[model samples]
Target: MATHLDLEEQEQLDQIKHFWNKWGTLITTVLVIVLGGFAAWNGYQYWQNRQGMQASALGSAVEAAVNSGDKARIDQAFGDLRSNYGGTLQAAHAGLLVAKAASDKGQMDDAKAALTWVADNASDDGLKATARIRLAAVLLGSQSYDEALKQLDAKMPTEFDAVVADHQGDIYLAKGDKAKAIEAYRTAYQKTAPGVEYRNVISVKLNALGEDVK
Candidate 1:
């Protein structure tokens, strides 16, 4: 009876050993992959948090400089933010603020530079469209009519179509193409949302061109 029990125990042990020998490496590999993926995900989360905090700090610095009207400090702060955190929303906002401040100070070149950066590199589509529109306006102010038209030619978000059309009308008018200007203004009028202040403005533009918005 003792020998029979011993043989049964040994057989069970051998079965377990066989199973481990067959599947051990695959199990280990699966566990390693899962654990590595978990670690990578945690690392990514921590990195994103660090980026957000740093971006927030830099954004505040840029805003303070803008409010103080310190052109040099604004440029420095924005430069740092763009260099280090260009992918963040904070950087995009800084670009817009810098452009506005520079434009207000009659620094057309600086304004164009800032707006061009935002138009090209901003992650938000709306912000990109806004930057392009503002840049076109700056070019228009300098009588760079062809350049203004080029800026307005880029694809824009759907919400900005009317505003872009309005800018096109202004550019064509500046170029003395009254027919094209009227056509562009009519497109702006038709695309603008009714009751929006922009529609009223477009109506005024159309009236100035002696065209009725159909």
Candidate 2:
């Protein structure tokens, strides 16, 4: 019985060796490819984490600069964030904060520059849309009606459609195109979420243009 068992084990070992002889190179190649992909994925994850940390630190610096009303610091921090971590959401958020701070400090050009960076380089679609809206507002304030309209022409997330339309209305009004302004206002009024407080403002604009919303 022991002899029979030994023979059976030997046969199993022989079968495994034969299988390896037939396919060892192919199996090793496949395993190496799979393991290499796993290593690459892990390396990418590590790189992303490092980038995120760097962006977060820069974002904090930008926030501090904005809080202190230090325009120069804000500009420097924003530039670093944009250059090093533009792919991160924190970069876009920091840009918006820097833009708002600059705008509040009466630095319209600086504000517009920051907003333009966000509009052009933000990784998130929603952030880009927000940047476009803000940039349009700045352009409108500067009386650059065509440029404002172009900013508004960029695609926005669905949640931003009403606001974008309203901004377009403002741009048209600034341009003295009351008819187009009224059309835009009406579209904004219709698209705005029901019961939104801002819809009343849109209604007023439309009403002022002789387009009653009953």
| CA lDDT, every model vs. true structure | 0.93, 0.91
Query: How do the residues 1-214 of candidate 2 rate in per-residue lDDT, one tens digit apiece?
Result: 9999999999999999999999999999999999999999999999989988888999999999899987778878888989888889999999899889888878999899999999999989999999999999999999999999999898778989899899999998888889889888888998987798999999988888888888
lDDT measured at residue 23 in model 1 versus the true structure, 0 to 100: 97
Candidate 1 lDDT tens digits, 106-210: 999999999999999999989999999999999999999999999989988898889899999999999899999998998898898788898989898888888
lDDT for residue 76 in candidate 1, whole number 0-100: 89
Best by the lDDT measure: 1
Model 1 residue 73 CA deviation in Å: 1.0
- Which candidate number would show the highest TM-score if scored against the true structure? 2
> Runs in model 1 with CA error above 4 Å?
1-12
**In model 2, which runs have C-alpha deviations exceeding 4 angstroms?**
1-7
